[model samples]
Target: MSKINHFKGVLFDLDGTLLDTIGDITYAINSALIVVGAEPITTSQCKGLVGRGLKNALKGALELKNREVTPSQLEELVPQMLGSYHRHPYRHTHPYEGVEALLDDLAKEGIALGVLSNKADSLVQPIIRGVLPTHSFVFIRGDKEGWPSKPEPDGVYAFSEAVGVPVDQLLLVGDSEVDYYTAEAAQVDVAIATWGFRSRERLLEAGCRNLYSSVEELRKEVFPWL
Candidate 1:
């Protein structure tokens, strides 16, 4: 197969793309749900809820429990979940197989790296530092006041600007339709990591192309020089 290696920078999605954080996220969500008298959801269910953002995840969890809450109520519940998550963020979270080696190789190739997630900025920063301390990223951004979330190009543009890479030269690697749409909106190249929250079939169903089954596949196909 022909190699594709035109990108100078990569923007990764945190939750499913680089790290498998469903366990801790599920724990936090369940903790908040139980406190609110709502039924707790399974880890499998939580996977479908995440990648959008914590608020959305919480909302989805409540829906799964057949409970509905107003926006104000949701706002209040988010902090509870956040507190639970902060207590033990990395309890079961870790980078995917071959992810560290991929990052190391990319860094050596002088490829700018950045992480952008819909997860809270406070949470995203610590997770990366704690989990992948060896790798240096140009920026690690997550949801915060005034910044729009993924599928909205704003974060993607910001990442491009921060890393000093043109949008055309940047590749957004992620594991969900949200990521695919984010790249589409930003007009940047996108490669979906199927080993993430969504399966290859699910991503394809969502109209995602350029799918890679693993970090190794991605490295070989997108960054052959590595």
Candidate 2:
């Protein structure tokens, strides 16, 4: 095992890291976009924009195919989008294959487990509970009103503090630029989850050094102590 994997805790980004939530996100986005006379986005298109939180994700999806939604239109549509997601967050959402086993192995290693996402705080727990009921995480937080999301270090700092783990001793595992920047800002090591939303090329372009291609690979590298 690499020395960097010897972490006190492992913090994950929910959308791309822990769960394959792109389908539901795409569906909700399209459902809401149609309400404003906009075109729908594909699941692939939604993957690239999944982790940036509500507004950014919506904006990216709206503009994906040269389709545009003004700030005013987006603001007006936010509530409908939120409501759609809240009502059907788990319609097509599920953990990446072997994620449950990977989480179990990490638990056996006696390391703290946490989830920090740009998804709404209220939505995070319910989605987790529905999709990953067996895994026990110590910290599951999403974008609370006052806290900045990932790529800003605020969420990472909050996770470290909440879990009582030193920033350097935590492994931030994710699959997007936001996740990469969060680790960079907080001065922590990162493991790129290849099975998540974005492309591996994008992660590599962003200078990701640790790439976990599968759950078995993740178990070997990140929780080998088990």
In terms of lDDT, the best-performing candidate is 1
Write the residue-wise lDDT of candidate 2 on 165-222 in tens digits: 8987898888887888788888888888888887789888877767878877877766
Which regions of candidate 2 are displaced past 4 Å? Answer: none
Best by TM-score: 1
The TM-score obtained by model 1 is 0.96
Q: After superposition on all CA atoms, what RMSD does each candidate show versus the true structure?
A: 1.6, 1.7
Please give the TM-score that candidate 2 achieves against the real structure: 0.93
Q: lDDT of model 1 at residue 194?
A: 89
Give the lowest summed-lDDT range of ten residues in model 2.
1-10
Question: What C-alpha lDDT, on a 0 to 100 scale, does residue 33 get in candidate 1?
Answer: 93
